[model samples]
Target: MSDPIAARPAQDRAGIRVICNDHSGRNSREAEAIDLAMKVLGPQAELCHVKGSDITETARAAVRDGYATVVAAGGDGTIMAVASALNGTDCTLGMLPLGTFNFFARGYDIPEDPEGAARVIAAGHAQTIDLGAVNGRLFLNNASIGVYPAILKERETVYRRWGRRRIAAHWSVLKTFWRFRRPLKVEIEVEGQRRRFRTPLVFAARSAFQLEHFGLQGADCIRDGGFSVFVTPDVGRLGLLSDALRLAVKQMRLGEDFELICADRLVIHTKRKRQLVACDGEKFLMDGPLEFTMVRDAFRIFTPPPGDEAAA
Candidate 1:
């Protein structure tokens, strides 16, 4: 397929600022990575360390200061935080993927190596892309409620004990499923149609590359400018566990594994006033009647050149 994203004009190198998260999952050598990044980015670019909660404000400040590019040097969560401020603005978003999964960065062909990624930023090639939003918050990949959020909550505990590894993430899923009970009862509204579902998880996906990477369906729908909402059947705990295993091995099937719903906008309501919603690996306690929507051409991001095989 031909690349749908077109590159924008080159940005001013002197106006670049990188906000880095030292606590990212794969950033064990944060000091070394930062030093390498600065050298590759040149003396013109600025780099600073900032906590997660302060990323948005810092990015906004950079924009106000006439920065041409604001790079997020961390995981998807950190990227999303900076995106919240840059979305709809002229400043392009750059990334150094220092996360465990690095799904968002990988999807755009952004390098995981800090110095290599810094070189991409220096090149100043960018493309406009869509982003998913839930109740006004932006997410680069996905957002979910139910079992997925529960898994994230458990994953933190496991990470604390075992450090942040892919194994620990997988382990948390199994542990959460073993103790999981009570499937959520949710009312969903899509395109003026209302439906009810009782399920263990409701996942809303915005990244076609992520779904394709996982061997799941709905990548085309997402590329066509919509979100794919996957609702797991109210299969009992044992059945859910079986499906989880299938997912781990990339052996999951449609219909039996999940019922897919595609829409540009949707609303979900549950009994609880507030629920734990996981967005790109970060958890948020949000109010009910959750709204999920896609914002097309939401922001510009630094990416590999068009027709680059890695981006494809």
Candidate 2:
């Protein structure tokens, strides 16, 4: 009977805000995107330019100003900040892929053209998706702690210089596999049961696929409130990475038992106090004693239609 979203009270006016990271290397596109949003969203929409120096503060301020829908326009980091700001609030969330490596955008298939994305936003067919919290930081898509996170932190400059594709996520995934010296030792608990395993990386997927060849469409949708746990145990490192890589690229169905696990919540303990975590595309070092739970139908999103649209 009561409305679930945290911040905004139910009201008549559609309070919407566009939060853009103008520095995402796609500034002109961003400007056009905002223009399209203005046309689509009309009088209710407001566009706010956010500086990188204070992403968190600026995003929250927009919500505080009464934005019922806050569209984050940039790469995954900007999404992280904007969504985290709006978490537990009543405001609806939206995405605009103005940055490199729009993994989150891939989840939604947002039009590469900013104007098209604005049209999708204007249509306002809102739906909900699951979210996760790691040491108080929120994640909308996936989180990986271990070699991937390490590589993300390491290759920040490489990504900036060579570009997102220059140090592609899979490339980093491979580089971390071969170069990382830190052997991963983690104790995992899923659905109240405990198990221990050693792995180079542990990725927590909240309702999405890492790759289409892995039957990514069959992969959980984030709003479903489930996690697909990727475990690499006892497999040859190079061969396993290669297999997973091929599976991803080819969009193949992965072997059931060794490569994946599905659960509603997971608790992970590591030997180190802080482990690197790559959530969606934002990298950070998080405290151990990490717990992730699948949140069913937690937050609202706007996506394309099924069949041809979704497949696109």
Top of the candidates by TM-score? 1
RMSD to the native, candidate 1? 4.7
- TM-score per model over all chains: 0.92, 0.82
At residue 229, candidate 1 shows an lDDT of 93
lDDT of 2 by residue, 143-205 (tens): 887666777765665666665553365566666656666558888887678888877778777
RMSD of each: 4.7, 3.9
Write down the worst ten-residue block by lDDT for model 1.
1-10
Model 1: CA > 4 A from native = 1-14, 308-312
- Model 2 clash number: 11
In model 2, state the lDDT of residue 312.
Answer: 33
